[model samples]
Target: MKTNVATTLAELKKNEKDDFYSSISFANEEIPLEQESVKRKLDKYLRKFSYLERSSHQIHRKADQLLPRIAKILKSYGIPDDFKYIAVVESSLNPGTTSHKGAGGYWQFMPATARLYGLRVNGKVDDRLDLTKSTHAAARYLKSLYSEFGDWTLVAAAYNVGGGSLRGSLKRQRKDNYYDLKLNAETAAYVYKIISMKTVLEKG
Candidate 1:
């Protein structure tokens, strides 16, 4: 009887191990996981997910709420639909959000950068908090960055770290590609964050 009980316990353990491995394989299969770069980005996404998950849901809700207006504006400006996800990663679609660095509004534009992008950022009326105006300003700034870098990923990185800084990094690193250039942690993760948000929003 003891021998039979031991054999049964061994079978149960083997079955449990097989089940766990199968679950992991199923999850990876569902997500179609591939590429080292994507895996790295997904890892970063998971680290930030605890803090950003609720905000991500809020962003999706806000996207649905404002879709018509935002879509019309984006269409008028000739910006791609996917660019809306940038705003999600920037401010979670909350117009009143202000970063520690003084970037404010749905697109999280710093005062100086906002002013340069044709946004009025005075004491009384900060246009950065105005969703319509801020989206337009963001579109214009993104268009200019796209013009300079000619690559959306590089443009997104430059948007986070500024065009001059990105240019300097490219020159110093002797690498024109954004992925090849080493950058500060925030700037390096910026594009990946945007990509992750885009993926989530699309899947939703």
Candidate 2:
């Protein structure tokens, strides 16, 4: 006898509804959830994103066009591919957007940061909007943060909250792990969003 996959799915869904209510009742009883027992379930929940498909064909096309040039520059400076996803999340391959705070371009560099990184800013031209130049600048900044924190997650967090801010948060939280730290909302979600975008885009 062959098992019907649709029937199995229906049964699983029924079981899931039962389990959800059961868990709710247990939670209301003030019982601590067993971390080990629920680890698989939590992993399954988070991995829902694994099915996400990248629909921005134009973004992929632009990334393909830009990545080789970006990678060549990063390689010359000894930077890592992890930084590429930052660009993916920042501008989605769009170079013309400016954040309300004045961050502009594919890498979204603010005016001060852009100037600090040796990018020129003028009335008519902002080098931060230049893809090749801004990517190289972001690489150098991320590399500097990596040297400071000695952790990729921390370095990535520093990109959002500033190295000084993350350093203070690390001390206050007593954890260097980015996911474990109580970061500002935007910074807290930033790394995970980047990872998710990269995973979907690469797989798609």
Candidate 3:
């Protein structure tokens, strides 16, 4: 099984490299492969010397295992198919993932946010660890965020930071565009990371 997994990953890496120069469409936007930002992210994922390259490899391997079921759930919730990569960015498709800040699960929902989205978070059962349930909760949360922001990129950013924080940023900065607003490092990189993951997975 380990050998098979290795062989599969090797093939996936080869395919990913072959398509590294191709553009990908997400949220009705075309991300040009030749763009410096895109190229940088691709390098970060594929380069042997980059620190994040190993993590990127693990993410793609996990994504290959998780995305089919996730895509089905996203479709059922009327969420954009590309939004599946949020799980890749959040928890790398690890259903049991927990963050230092107390977020948990494949979608990295905090306890309160999980409950707010109708996910159970009691001691007996943490629904956040249940991929299907957490995905539904994430879809609902994302739908609400999109309703508030009207931009998928902003929605992705807001998912990392709270919607209130994003709204406050918009108000203070007087700019509604996600790329235009100066944000904390993590929030700023959130959408771009998702896009990068999407590109790698789609190409692989």
Q: Pick the candidate with the highest lDDT.
A: 3
Task: Give lDDT per model, in order.
Answer: 0.74, 0.70, 0.79
- Of the two candidates 1 and 2, the one with more favorable TM-score, higher being better, is 1
Model 1 Cα lDDT, one tens digit per residue, 55-91:
5576667778865676677768776666676787788
Per-residue lDDT tens digits for candidate 3, residues 136-197, read: 89989989998988888788889899999999999999996776678898887677777766
Angstrom error of the Cα, residue 19, model 3: value is 10
Model 1: which ten-residue window has the lowest total lDDT? Answer: 24-33
Per-residue CA lDDT of model 2 for 1-204, tens digit only, reads 247988898899979855743442110122122444333433342254344333336777776788777777777777766567678778876889888998888888889998888899889889988888997798889888878997776777789889999999989889956656777878877766665555555555
Q: Residue 169: error of model 3 in Å?
A: 1.0
Instruction: For candidate 2, give the lDDT of residue 198.
Output: 56
- Candidate 1 ranges with C-alpha deviation above 4 Å: 1-38, 46-56
In model 3, the worst 10-residue window by lDDT is 45-54
Where in model 2 is the C-alpha error above 4 Å? Answer: 1-55
lDDT of 2 at 96: 91
lDDT for position 163 in model 3:
93
